[model samples]
Target: MIRLPASIRAACVLAVVSALAACANRAPTQFYTLLAPAEATPVPAESGYAIELLPVVVPEQVDVPQLVLRSGSGALQPVDTRRWAAPLGEELRTALSARLSARLGVRDVYRLASPASLPLYRVRVRVGRFDSVPADYALLDAGWSVERRDDRSVRTCDARYREDVGAGIDALVAGHQQALARLADDIAATLRRFDAGGCPDTRT
Candidate 1:
């Protein structure tokens, strides 16, 4: 039997202990995505155009993979154990794409070559502020615009949505999802009135 020397064996034992300690101390990360809620029947777009949803502009503080939650005292907390399934910006864009396409019954034409004959509405969203507070609410404030590709017509508007949440990570994520859904609702309505000056009334 070829056995290790005493010093080498001791060092090997120490290394094993360190690795096990790291594994024990490190918590498993949980990923979450913004999902569309069950809505009413799908309605075809009034303009019969596909959507070119640009990548969302998320706030710098919450743009990372971790969830940046707001504390009761207004301090920001980035929880590493609770992370987004994708980059925060992509997650927001994906959620909007799903909800908006479903609502308008159009396909997402992002980064795809669409024939010039097809009408396309380019939608852009920039998040001014985002806050997630457990047991309180998730707030999303964003300025979004929709531009008609052919006529260069545009509708620019900003909306702030808040959804109350229970105390937990899942509830917090669900709140944000609902908030984004509301934003989608307004945007969808505005798309129907592409050339209108005022934004849709989301009150109720």
Candidate 2:
């Protein structure tokens, strides 16, 4: 077997090393960025109808079924674009409390267990869909509904609101918050009706 000269072999080795160094130094193409938590602008009270929220009823399939979206095939993933916020239930509860308190002028808007709460109404939310599509750039979808315990009436048209969120958790949070804002408006409307005696008595 014929062997290459020492100088040529050294030159070839240097070329291979230089190529590897270039490859290593190249800019990364798999760009992945996580979004920061969104700041909530507190809603000011509007109607003076105080209400306390009950523990939200989340679907049974997820660990925090109240926050993440699960697929039909049982894939549990976050739909909220904001990964830094509280779980879906808690976040929704806090957001709703802020908005409702601002609109209704509730003395204390809190979870069900808060003491000294006055004439507090109960709000229940049901999530219908929440998940992400990993293919073709991650896409998030979240659906939800809210209701009052006193009347057994459903809002969200059967917990059905959908938002196509971006890949960032903050984007997801925005989407979820938007849906909740819509839901809170519906609930607030109903609460106003209740206050105005517009709701019919079902006792009959």
Judge candidate 1 against the unseen true structure and give its global Cα lDDT, from 0 to 1. Answer: 0.79
Q: How do the predictions measure up, each by TM-score?
A: 0.82, 0.50
lDDT of 1 by residue, 1-204 (tens): 244454553444344334434654575877899865566786665446788999999889888888887755466767667789999899999999888888878888899986677798899999998998665678999989999888898889897898876656788899999899899889889888776677888642
Kindly list the per-residue Cα lDDT of model 2 for residues 128-187, writing each as its tens digit: 444432211122222324344445554432334455544333454456556666555666
Candidate 1 Cα misplacement greater than 4 A, ranges: 1-26, 37-47
User: lDDT per model, in order?
Assistant: 0.79, 0.45
Count of backbone clashes, every candidate in sequence: 0, 17
The candidate maximizing lDDT is 1
Q: Which ten residues in a row have the lowest lDDT in candidate 1?
A: 12-21
RMSD of 1: 13.4
TM-score of 2: 0.50
